[model samples]
Target: MIKSLSVDETDTNNIEADVIVLGRSLPGVVVAHRLRQKFGDTMDIKLLDLSGVVDNYSSRNVTFQVPLGEDDRQRESLDAADVYIGNVAHRYIMHYMTEFNIPIPETLFRTEVSDPPQKMYQYRDGRVVTSPNDYHEFSFLNFFQRLELNNYQSSLDRRMSELFRGRREDDADSRTLRYYDRTSMESDLVSFLLLSESRDVMRLVVRTVCGASAHSVSLLFYLHQCYRNGGSRNYVGGANTSLREKLLGYCRKRLTRKLQQSVEDITFLVKPIKTIRTYSDEQVIVETTKGDYNYVCNQLAMAVRPEELSKISFEERLLSNLWEAVESARGLRPRQTKKFQVKYAEKFWRQRGFSGEILSVRGPILWAIEKPVYSTTGSLEKYSTLVGFLEADDEDEANSREAVLAQLVELFGAQAASPTEYRETEVEGFVPRCEDYVALRSLARTSSALVVWGALDLFADGDLAAALEAGHSAYVRLVLSMRPQAQDFDDLSAMQWRRVLPDTSFVTWFNTLSYNDGFRYVMYCGALYLGYRVFRKYIIRS
Candidate 1:
């Protein structure tokens, strides 16, 4: 039987736990799991969320890519040629394969190239490096033969030439030999020979309202996070299923089954709690939608968003400072962010010789992922799917959808472009807004006991994984300090608390330098910096 805990019938005096964790999210779930894993069943731990399960799916489906214009002008020029090469080759091979109904290879690993148009251009260290088009294709064909997919490759090439019989020889050459060969070479070489190469190429760029800018975040931190264990590669179920199903499976596996109870009004204790007065040595009184309750604990852990806490009344005015930090933090509007999943009718995309992924410089959709998963039979077929994420509001959603569809049609033709399903999740207060909150610790007296946690605390430094990690660390320290046997709490040393909490000064420095001038500047510069760093470290790292 699965053990479950519920707040609906919680008794304050009966509350028996060494630790009580409030709120539920990725961070909360992690903290709870860690505690349970380390301490076992000895501690009575309870996790409370107004909503039973944290719905990460709200903003999970869509992953953003940086605009093509952001690439160096010289690299862009090369990519243009690469695009021409890739299209021609892909189109020819796809036509060839289709005519013979040959099964295209299920996996395609394209080579990443970084050749600036001019020698004068300084290539950013760790950016992707691609080979010349012809060489790239040769490498791909070599790999195909090694993998014993040469039959498919030959048939594809032959069919492609036949399809374009009347076209100019150069046009045919561009499509059949140049593009097809280079793409194949790149994919094959990467899979077979230089498997250890770390190109740091930009694969998928996801845009969300995280608490901080991209540059300030550590690259390694996100690689292991964002998804649960096993990382992105293990998460692939195949092209037949949507990404959402896979993600939900991960969440289900890790989330605590015991903490599935609903939180009722009367049983929850609210801090600086309204409509209740505490007597000397009396426990903190709390009022909830369900009823009234009291909590007696040596210490408290607050995991609520700062803005939400600001609405409550507090006896001491000093508490307002915490709220001020929260308001100053960045946030997102509900309708501004959207998530989409688009599926292709068949695996015919590869027959056209295109990688499953595409980035548009000036298109309605910013990025597309091809064949995100596989089928039961293990054959790459017409049932392949592509997932696309676009930035749009309710008013622009329809137009954006149409625009993305048109782009797909242009790239893969009408037969390959069709919508399976589209989902929109309106997330409010989504962006990171926490850097300043971390800095405020400097201004806070060592005697201050109140500390706030949420997006404001996490995003202040512009690193989501770091922020979440830091938040967890802070909670651990706070809990340790409050322990009866801990030296700081026993001795009442303010200095000890400083060492336990974050260095507010460092947080402030990052907030000021990175998120200066509010949301707009952060949106353009801060986010881009964060995205690029993440791409280099997590997405591209081999």
Candidate 2:
């Protein structure tokens, strides 16, 4: 049932398989692994990727770091609940680590930043800037006045305040997904942020937050990004690469039945699948672009985007909702995120008594962090380093070396301008793969092997938790479909919308704050901490 296809092997080109999972996304990998876990070697499975790569950024070499911070009150509140309140994003990842018996690597503090944020310099038309150490008039109130010349900031100022000031019931309108879906993020930002000094300062904020220009994203999608990341001030270790390596590795190891095994084993093909067709008998045909072979299967699990899904010519049109999803999908090509990582033999910035974190509205970098390669020590680690990120427009390496050095000289002193070694990459955008979501119900049961709904879940904020849920749901549906005679099956997606994990500090802090506190991440974070101390222990506990 599971046969590799080649031009020479005409007999096996149309061999029938039980299931074919497409794309190597985490969801697809999980589907492949779980189906193998459930079905064993009794069924034929073929995992595929059209890109001929396992990961989107597989070719790019970049070190990952998870940010670490918690709203103080949220941590305490979560602690009192006496349940697992670990990072929801990486929660399933940890589960897979345990299930697969693989160690999740803790990334080192590879970079360091010696300065605290809010030392940020904001510039406008004519490179108008106040020194990092001196933005004396830079409170939330006057910031709009300073940035607004043609009423750009003025337009968005009030709306920005209103967006955050609403109560919980107000945000409960995500049903059509259209409440946040209909408008572009640019139109949303138009009320307040302007491209001051050739830089869309507001655009940089959106890019830093959502990973795309406002024009490319939806307003509600932007809000969810803030809501999901827990208001942006939270932190974690970093994107652990070992989680992925182990998960995929384990699936490959377990799914590949040995040559001695009597049952037909799962097989994988690296070729890009170009077409999919289904027969009335519930059998499926998958073909590659190179005319190497055609595959016959009962089902297909897709882990790619909708637009990519459209590329494969299906023998019959899928469900109307699926077609709508394909048409409505935000073909938003994530913008390029440029970063610079500099390594030093000494922790120079830390020696000067700084946190090494930098945030700027000027140029070269939107934000940068200096982390130590060794996690135990912060200011004195041997592998001292600095990593800087370009926000939006100036992401390209245009005279980047000079521009980076100049900014470093201003913040961390002249010594920082030179490093023993440095690396840069246009890291993948942080934006979710899909903005306007295609409802799963609408696309459900469209074809014999059209398990494409799970891939769209990736667009549901790009959070690993979301993808895990989506993939798990697809696996259940696929199981029920293949075994129509089976009387029982569990539906995980049915209850996905009911779970709620709140970060106490953000909710409490957000409620207490004035509506005018917009784009002031530092100010809000400081106030969150202050409120936690007063309200959590002193007043409430008292």
Candidate 3:
């Protein structure tokens, strides 16, 4: 007989759920949603978040751009690979939905693509392999000129697309198709090159996408398996909401209904969780802020970083290897990121016949997204705003903003850069620093518990997507291990864990000196993919 678990009386038992999600971030939300989709009303789920309110910035602030290089061949390769991966990922998620008898809107399957621009670059092999949309075909052929290279690229794309494509014919409205057209070429080029060089490249690419460092992660961590297997068309308003606002809205609609009314403190005992106590082969007692809570599961899936996990209390002495791995995991010092939104009374840039997306490549204000958001009242009377982000490292916040504004004015002239209202958001935590990042990865292995032993595998080095994927994978593995079926022990475990390994082959080839341009392109793609994956996974889980 299946028995239900209960929390302390002080914790409101008013809400009953099968899962108690601890955090309300993106991962939490994603997991919650997925579970709901899988079990519907049968699964009682609740969420407990720190702030009691979901921050929408996580979703609305995102800028989705299919990075295109100046080379045609490189662009084709990247575009093709992106499409292949996206479709495969989407398909895998859809399979889960079908297996679990979930009901979702049919519209979720509809994906859309924007028109291809005239001038574009495909960067590969550290050079501009092709330029202009007109030369895309020629560049693809030229870059893959070698008989073996061409065959490999073609085969990889075909196999990936075949495995994931739900729709028989490629349709214009498919976002997956559009992404493929834009990024597959570069991805294939990078994949092929990495497979040829050190296997570490593929591992790096995969880990980078998942949000881990190459040195500690396995080479098979694929983000495609962690994605929601489908796409949606952008609303007519043009995805105008801020990232934070979008995520918060989703939380309000789905998560708020499942939370307990009290706040619980989180504290560590004995520095780290060493031995987890099991009683009568039924319940596992864990130390928490309120006291010891009994959990009936054989494994615990934590969504926190390895460094954070080290702070939890364990009942028994953990294996030396797991302890060392956890101890070795690096802590990330928060970095400061600032965003400035300048609103103007009129369309000054448009009046000057300029497209709002302009780049002052050499200036502190690198680029600007014109008219990023729309007024809530549905009137165009509101002023158009220019949103600019500045990368400030160890600099005074006020000074950095001033310098960026001043530089913008110099590039666009006083009239164009002038704004009637200015708003800025300063983000302090996990600043993106390349040097410090490399150092952290080198130290992240500090645990020996099979679960904690893979602490290094859990170190994302700031790749949010990989972190989210790892969390989900961990959760799934934990759950399956507790209730193992006859057929569940085969290749499933390998496939699941392999998804956490960094694809070293891909990383080495993409980072090769000859493919510097492709390397940068791949990095950007990996970062964005990680962010999206993390947000989706965490939000639902929470």
Candidate 4:
């Protein structure tokens, strides 16, 4: 059973713990659990949550009624559309789940039965075009168009592989990495679209997955996210389904199957932290809003969102010292996403021989996928759950439930008009859009007792796997600090969290041809030749 500390429970003047972790996110939980596993009962470790919930990620989960056997209606199903287990988070999540005896859910791509038809339909100019296994097989696309699409996809993957895994110790490659980081995805897309593009496929793909327009997203950040956690092969095309489809199939109302054990051994406190005052690398005082007690801990790990830091008060020295991190956190812009699900009694799309996957440029619905539901006995049920996302920040009309249903009706016929249950959730969170991740890294503060960990702080990626990795790294650092003699762990300690502002000056950008090293070199040679010619002409005239 889940347990938490009440307001009256923490009425003591002082509460002491060896370590205190703030934020109930996966990263914070991992840090607390790892520390407990390492030190056992020897150390007093405490994990705190403001929301009074262990897994804050699953807080948005919706539970609804599903009819059970003969006059009993207790049987129910979970709908967890937002939580997606990516390839990066798979290994770490599996390890913890197995240790805690958590049951894994079925995969969206490979099921007990044969694979479903693999296709994503795009509603183009008055017609629906299929996203096929091979672009060559797409009859609507001409040979040149097909060739361009294939080239673009392969080139993107290849570039991402190099930027992420290539030897960055080299100067040329390092500069190249920085170049991409300073560039926007929209600029890259514009260059590609200039070559007689038939449709805005790249824009659609980026918008559907990122939940933001290409112009706002950093090129390097976008590619890094796609490249991380097993890259594009796990989600897009061929054998695997797209990210949108995976989210739809993964709609679970409860995470019990995923999290049977809630790390019950550790002491759990339910209070919103008001301030963190750091004196040295080894000692800090944490104050909560509800309790008169002050938490004195040897170490404090921050696993919350970057923006959340503004809510808590820190010592003046720590704030002045970590100014770059504070600014980067404040610089992060909000990315709004609205997810909706409609449930029906029948699998209408399957009956019509449809894949239930759609990508549309039309109003309201940006993307949609059909998910299959199973009964408690592990048998496929005769129900349809259509889950999709809409652009919440830009589309004002698409904000309503009625607008969504009308769009669905237009796409899936009269049956879409009535859904047994319709639910929608709108989320406004800070994403790594235009933020300088290089600066965010400065918040690592590994040497200090106040270790900060945000989604974009270290790996510059926001996937669950990255968060788990961060938690593990923080644990190792904390351990090494306490035990200086131990050196078996990987040397991830060299990563600097200092933020470096990109050179956006007009002269600097002009000289580098907007960060194009190759083009700049060409211009350099041209200028030298022209200069020599002018000198020769002056000498002859004299």
Candidate 5:
């Protein structure tokens, strides 16, 4: 996926495209595919990809498929992978697969035997407790403690569901979303949950799910992510099959060859553009670094990060509040996370009657799931692996085989001491949270001819679901620009409506101020007022 193409400047003249999609990541591909499906031979869409830049934030590469013969029950395991598909993602993906006659992966089609087919356990107090639900298994928690946990979880779920209960276009829901976006997940948890234990538990869940601390993530973003993925229940409901892998696998297996033969071209490796010159909304002139190539296109879809977009110079017409947001986003550091897999000779945890799915509040390791190795004959292998995330930022520490294995030994037993092979992958350059949701709202309100959405954008919610959703939004924006009379736009087509931001507003902060916060503010204000009164009455008169 990281290869450069060196072409002569004169060859740029051959690049005649009606639409040019920048960044060939999952979102970019989906946008192009959707466009091609609608326009057919009428439009010439070209994919322009930059090496090592696109898909750096994606978790898709974390997990992959290793086929077990020609059977449907294909052995898809983790290099270090995490995929969460909620109702929204599942519905759209299923529709897309059905339309294209692509085979649905077995992971998505599995039947639910119980309340939850997969059981998740949390590592706590030198023992493991069932997570989110299954109260009977929570032996570590007292009756009262369990009650508090259950209450906190229920409230969280209700709030997540209520975020978009009505319609995306509804004024009430919009306001609610804005209010949530104007607040941090940390703030919400601290205010809503009474106990610090409850707060810590919630924060741990947020970190595991979103790969960022609760304080750094907006409440709206977290809720929307959970809601979109089906709900908070399904969001933290253990590991699911990799949707991104499935989609990409289908494209590589079925569509790549066929697409190459069509009018649309998947230009995998292209040099970075020097400038994007637009005379009108319908006319786009893209110049390469050498200025030897001029790719003339009618429209442009930028599925790149803000930093990437900052590289290319564009005319004033293409600039808006979104451009300003992009300027602000370029300087923001993305959320970072690391993935590791510990290969062991035996399933030691399973021997102790544990499911091997472990979550921790304190960690170098935050969340882990058992990944049993499978032979080509579709039988289980003696060796098994524990795949999960590392909370460490330092490269040496994250990649440290001993540090990870030591933690495993503490959690499991002495049996976890010897690992056959240890592997680690560091993932960075994720979508960072904006300073406030008002910024996102302002950006969303501003419409532009150029459709832009990125997997690494500040406004992005930092998940494959968001990328997929935003891709369709980009396509809708492009389509609406071309055909204003088009009535087929989905309810989720508006990108502005979905792009969430952090709650950093002073006004919002004051409005949702807690009893403790209100008391402190009142005390500080009282002290200041008293000092001012004394100075004015005595010092000024003298």
Candidate 6:
């Protein structure tokens, strides 16, 4: 029951909805997915998007695929690595998979990149931090494990818990939050992580995850994001596009599944939403980019970042706080990110006795991992892929792949200088990456009918799990606000909305975070940029 906009449907102004959700982000999909399960065909839900589900991150590197025999469709399934954002192990995705009875593949980690515990390095100020055994190296995980920076880790966890927990907090948590909110992540790192080595490591993690350099981000705000994704341990997004693709595949199936009947009850509008205005009867009108359609609905849930929201117009102007939120979100935008994959003759790093994961303070590329090859057959795949994230500011810079290869020389020696085959893909930063997060916090005005909801950053930061919580929360708020008085839906039990698999177990409990510290790893995010320059440039020039 999916319909595309047709000529007859253009500018109809008759499109109706019990619920209208904007943005095709993971949160929006989850929100609609939840509604489909709860109300089934009974409730009319319309989801509109200016982009694809999960936004830019989904399509950036997906253009090409690995080859096998003669078929390009012979996809290679890679082992889990840290490519996804937040909790790869306990994916909220499991909910849809289980509900649909989709089989879950056991995660196989091909950690051995070489025999002698593969070598890893930290390049800073023309120096390398490594073991006396030239080949002995560590993943970002192992480097911190050796340092044991427990105190700093504990402090960060405490700050996050005080700020981002969903339930009501005591005065101590409130005071803790106020004290930390005033400082930036760089300031806190300098004060808490004493060793220059520790700071160097800490800098990378802060930059990559937070999207800007540590100095630019508020410590309070960053911690709130960490908390939303279920504390520090949950940050794992595995290789390729497995996680997102799976989620989307299942969601689409659920959307198209027949319940009651209509020719194409679920409509997926591919174009961007141009303007959103309100009319006399609390009706929200959504105009599409091509003017091919107009959607009229009573409620709106913007499951997008704050900046994305400003793209649309509202009947009444946004108040200062609301406007300020959008501006602040613009400041937190993700930096231009590029990931590269190189095919090697064999698992060279594993032979050297190391897991091919590298986190750097200085990089043409920040993080590197030995991602497993996508193999259709259950046979030993000899061809290996080395995937890494690079700091590409613009088209010219991103196209200069040679700069990254030079860095690899320093990391793995001359043998690493060249791969049998090398290719790189750039991922555009999500335009609304952190927009909804900023707006929700700064919003001071409220409307009875037209509203936006979802996890911009629930508890101050948003990620996959928080996205689910945000979607569910938005649904709850909609039901509450749309039907203020006791209504037919009031009697609906909360049990119906419960996900088949709740993420509570994998999420680190607030009361439980102990402040143990360790070595730092990950990134040193570059300056913020609107999109991946190389992709746009290539498209334009082509």
Residues 1-542, model 4: lDDT tens digits: 44666446555676778887776555666677777776788878877655565542343322222222311222223223323444444544444444553334444333323555444444445356654343224444566665555555545655665555444322236556667767777887566543333236566566665667778777776776665445533333222333422244232222222331344555364567788786564578888876567788887777665556567777775555676666677566556667777888887767766666665655456766665554444455535787776656744434467988887776678998998988876544345555464445445533464544432222212233455556766776777666545534333422221222333456333432322344467799999999999999999999
lDDT of 3 by residue, 384-422 (tens): 766644434435456555666565565456874567877
- Per candidate, the number of residue pairs that clash is 55, 29, 109, 9, 2, 40
RMSD of each: 22.1, 11.8, 17.5, 9.0, 9.9, 14.9
Error of 6 at 79 (Å): 16
My TM-score estimates for the predictions, one after another, are 0.46, 0.64, 0.46, 0.73, 0.73, 0.67
Scored by lDDT, model 1 comes in at: 0.34
Better of 3 and 5 by lDDT: 5
**TM-score of decoy 2:** 0.64
Question: Mind sharing the TM-score for model 1?
Answer: 0.46
Q: What lDDT is reached at residue 508 by model 1?
A: 35
Q: What root-mean-square deviation over C-alphas does model 3 reach?
A: 17.5
Candidate 6 per-residue lDDT, tens place, 142-257, comes to 44433434445655665555454434433335445555655677887786656676676667666556435676666766666555445543332222223223221222232223
Question: In angstroms, how far off is 177's CA in candidate 2?
Answer: 3.0
> Residue-wise lDDT of candidate 5 within 1-542, one digit each (tens)?
33344445345455677788887655676678777877777877777776545332233433332332442344333221122333665555444444554554433323222444234444445455554343223434666555555655555656654455444433445666667777888887787666665666677767766667888888877766666655565544334432222222332333222332232344546777778877656677777787655777777777666667668887766664366665655555555566777777777776665656666666777766665433334343334777776676524443557767777787677888888888776545353363554455344334356544433233232244455565666677677777666536452333333323333456334434444554578899999999999989998789
Clashing pairs in 4: 78-252, 78-253, 79-252, 79-253, 80-251, 80-252, 439-499, 441-497, 442-497
lDDT of 2 by residue, 139-217 (tens): 3224444444223322232233334324442364445455456677666555434433323544555655554666776
State the RMSD for candidate 2.
11.8
**What is candidate 3's CA lDDT for residue 388?**
49
Question: In terms of TM-score, how similar is model 5 to the real structure?
Answer: 0.73
How does each model score on lDDT?
0.34, 0.48, 0.35, 0.55, 0.57, 0.50
Model 1 ranges with Cα > 4 A deviation: 1-18, 52-285, 289-291, 305-311, 315-321, 329-335, 374-383, 394-399, 419-429, 433-471, 484-542
